[model samples]
Target: MEKKLERIINNYLYEDIKEIQKSENLRNLGLDSMSSIELLISIETEFDIQIPDSYLVPGTFENFEKLKETIESILLP
Candidate 1:
């Protein structure tokens, strides 16, 4: 799951996936509002899950771990 998530994020980032730390801020890595939306769509499609509106926030996409946690919570819970 983490690897898939990394691949998804790598699509929008300029930096190499190997250089992106789980705690690193995605926005700083090139995730803007536009790319974020595309990223959300990609994730939903890839995971075949609808993210709740409550989870749609800047903080959810703040870093890799946060995004993974959000998806895991929705999928697991």
Candidate 2:
């Protein structure tokens, strides 16, 4: 799941991922509102899940791990 999430993020992020980690904040990775929206759309399309706007807060997308966890929670439960 982490790897897949990483791939999705990589498709949108322009930064070099050599030193990137799951714990790193996505905003720190240069994810502005535009890229964030793209990511949300990509996640929905890839996972076939609808993430409610209530879960679209900054904390949910704070990092790769957090985003992965949030998505898993929605999909698994």
Candidates' TM-scores?
A: 0.95, 0.88
- 6-74: candidate 1 lDDT, tens digit per residue: 999999998966685779999999999999999999999999999999999999999999999999998
Off by over 4 Å in 1: none
* lDDT by candidate, in order shown: 0.93, 0.83
Question: Lowest-scoring 10 consecutive residues by lDDT in candidate 1?
Answer: 13-22
lDDT by residue (tens digit), candidate 2, 1-77: 66677778887666644357778888888888889999999999988999988999989878888888889999899
Residue 47 CA displacement from its true place in model 1, Å: 0.3
Candidate 2 off by > 4 Å? 16-18
- Candidate 1, lDDT over the whole model: 0.93
